[model samples]
Target: MEYMRTVGRWRRVVRRVAAVAAVLVPLAVVSVVTAGPAQATGCRTNAHVYLTSVYPSSYRFENQPVDGGTDDYQMFAGDSTSFQVGGNGLRPYTSPAWRVESNVSGSFVFNGRVAGGNCVANETTVGLARHTVAGEVWTVRANYLTGNSGQFIQNQAHFRIFFVDPPPPEPWYWQPCYYAEACF
Candidate 1:
């Protein structure tokens, strides 16, 4: 009888924890969504870098950390930072999404999605680059990541059967399990 009572108590504790988590998780999401744009106002709340295009809206790209563990990485808006590459996420680049007053017509600004902007770059052109958590930044114009090819490992559930790239050809596309978007 005492064992059953203890089990009941444990179940109640689990239920209470689950209920609290359910409530708090949504609130955390709402707070993040609400904070993104508000923190980013007036051309830029605080830009980590400025991407210059022949037109800012004309040329936009997505990038991720090569190591995905703790090495170099790229920055995008509305993305969550994670230690692993799979844990990172990205949203499509939108024109005039976050702006700051600039004389350069094709210039736009970008920052981290969740918290205060980290790195700020001025007079920098939008080229292929990788940055680090240690506040180091660099750009790369060659050897960019192409999801159009290889169609790398991705997880999409088609009625739970699960679909992935063929084993042999194994292209490098990463557009699954990520809100129908790309994740590095």
Candidate 2:
């Protein structure tokens, strides 16, 4: 009789262990499966638009006479500048023109024009540019033109280089296991 009771106790212990393992094994597997891919995947980057301009004396007046005497109205001083991103191969993003006013005495009347619309890209992937990777730098050319009275006068060119960093990877989830497993 004692031996029978011992056997029964041992059986009960084994059953309890099996039940606990059944509950725990799936949880362990789910955590591993869900976490492994997110950690293992490589980083990714996306391209975006950015514009930076200097204040005061950044642009010249077009069509105005030099010293108000010479017909040579080159980049005088005070007007908005247009910048193009990418190059001849891509359509340039043009910035709004800023007007500059100056007195004949070399004194600045109006320094620069204020930006009116949205200028920067909010998303990582913008327009037709391919997604950028971490540590990648892009060289963009800007063609500047100044105009007055609807006539273009002075022309200048510049370049802007931008650096990109990879964005964080998305988390991973096993859809089927998540829905099917009863031990959620």
Candidate 3:
């Protein structure tokens, strides 16, 4: 009968609309969920270390001064349990072009190499016992070692970077550089 055909057509149309809605509603919901603001991590806390000087041994540089010349470095403290350090240095003929290193003293241990111009960091992390170093400030005597010997340029170079605990993250906000010791 004509009435039965009309009912069948309406049911088909309703089923199509329901199927489309099922797909679209979840897609919209996923977009909104992902778009929400990122939660702040404890790693953002103020943590910094300054070189104040460069000490390259025979394997590093022959005779380079750690003064007036350019020194490159970066330091980041993650929570109170881990930290990261990376940077490059160019000391002319006396020293090699660049060197990089990092250390983590917390539950998550991490180490990386200085490759592709010091921009890319590969996470080869492993789990360890987490240990906390109290406070939000610390320093280290970072050294560059080449071969089995340390090297230095003709003159010493003084380099330093100030650390800050933060609600903001940017290079410009670091502390001013101050003289420490000569890199002989």
- Clash counts for all predictions: 14, 5, 30
TM-score of 1: 0.25
Q: Candidate 2: lDDT of 104?
A: 25
Model 3 worst lDDT run, 10 consecutive residues: 40-49
TM-score of each: 0.25, 0.26, 0.23
lDDT tens string, model 1, 71-168?
12233312121211011112112111232222222333333222212211223222223222322232211111122221122111101011122235
What's the C-alpha lDDT at position 170 in model 2? 95
Ranking by TM-score: 2, 1, 3
Tens-digit per-residue lDDT, 37-109, candidate 2: 6643322221122233322222222323323321111221222323322111111232322222222222111
The C-alpha lDDT values of all candidates are 0.30, 0.32, 0.34
Off by over 4 Å in 3: 38-184
How does candidate 3 fare on TM-score? 0.23
lDDT of 3 by residue, 81-178 (tens): 32233323321112122222123231112233332222222222222233323232222222332221223332223232233344455555545556
* CA error at residue 134 for candidate 2, angstroms: 33
